[model samples]
Target: MQNLDILTEDHYVLSAHIFEPRQNNRRILLINSATGVKQQIYFSFAQFFAEKGFTVITYDYRGIGLSKPNKMRGFPASMRIWGTKDYKALTSYIKTNFPGYHKFCLGHSVGALILGMNKDSEMFDEFIFVGTQNAFVGNLKLRTKIEAYLGFGIVQPLSTKLLGYFPASWFGLGESLPSGSAFDWRTLILNKKSTNKLLEKSDDFSRNLTQKVFVIRAEDDLWLTEKGVLSLLHNTYPDLKPTYRLIKTSESEKNEIGHINFFRSYNKKLWKIIFTRLEEGSHNVED
Candidate 1:
């Protein structure tokens, strides 16, 4: 694994890591992490793909992990910037470095939502969505909906106001995030249009994507819901062909593949499901 810094068009430096394969299959994978989630969470997953002859790249978005500013307070970063600039920069780096390789992107949670902001999303041959959805409160379960209302509607805003950033880790959501990024997260849950509401600020390409998307959701992920997942497909990315798979908790050896645990090394066996879809997608499955 080699660490690198990629500069976005706005001149912001993003911390990234590339896992090189000993044997090349000419296939490349770019992993976009969930909101406030660190790139290190994907190291094992990236290494596994690398051993399988697929070069994998993982990076932290601005105001996240290694890419964060010296102080969380007043940091200037948001999800919109993540897609419009940071994600775009990564794709540009991949295109310039691995021109002939078959490219695939694996987006986790908010990682998938940002696709609409950047036209470079079209460059990938296929996409893999893990634990992602519109995440509107109306699309969630009653219990989760209440929590969403309380947390995002009240707690998040209050904390962000006091700290100049959202302490996401305090809620077990992930790491702390810039205030703008935190507000965008709140917008996703509170806004009826969900992802489309966020896209209004940028060039909308959510419907332009026509690639096959492997959509994977964990059954026990309390924050995820079927209604939200379907809404994301039909509303935000209607043009993309989707093959859905509901991963039962029993499928996990530890019986735990929550929103984040799906990528954990303990769940390595489940990774094959992704490999099969990218390696050879002959099945149009909705499990």
Candidate 2:
């Protein structure tokens, strides 16, 4: 494992880690984290792939985890910047140092939504969408929709306004986020265009991607739904070819695979679904 600092084109430094495979398989996997989630959350998952001879890497977006600044207030980081600058920097590094390798990117939640913001996304041979969706309120379940209205519609904006940042941890939303990041997140739920609204504000390459994408949805992920997942694929990434897999709790060792826990060490066995799919697309790894 190697830890290093990568500087974005805008001169901001991002914290990153790389896990080298024991036997070089010429395959690389980049795990992009969800909103307010740290890269450390993917360490075990990355190591699992590394052990299987896939060079795996992880990094935190700005204002989250190691890439965060000492002061949270007024930090200028939005999800758009995550893809355009932070993610692009990582791709630049991989393309330059690991040329000729088959690159695969696993996008968790917001990680998947940001793909449209960067052109580097085109280089990946395939993409893995985990616990991600369009997240428009209209696509959510009844319970989740009401929660979204009360939270993102009221609490999120008020809290972000008061603190100049969002103290997301108070609500079990992981680390605190920069004010801009918080607002951008609200756009996903409250805006009629959902992710497309954010994409319009920045560079959009969603339609350009036609690679096969393996989509995984945890049955117990309250924030995810078939409607939401299909919305993302049809509305935001219309050009991509997606194969869906719905994982039931019974498949997990602990009978739990929520929005983030599928990548948890306890559910390591579930990683095989991804491995099998990537190894041979025709292997019928669908769950």
Pairs in clash, predicted candidate 1: none
Q: What is residue 279's positional error in candidate 2, in angstroms?
A: 0.9
| Model 1 clashes, total count | 0
Error of 1 at 128 (Å): 0.3
Q: Which lDDT tens digits does candidate 2 get at residues 208-262?
A: 9998999999999999999989999999999899999999999999999999999
TM-scores for every candidate against the unseen true structure: 0.97, 0.97
RMSD of 1: 2.7
Mind sharing the TM-score for model 2? Answer: 0.97
Residue 53 C-alpha lDDT in model 2: 87
What tens digits encode model 1's per-residue C-alpha lDDT throughout 246-267? 9999999899999999999999
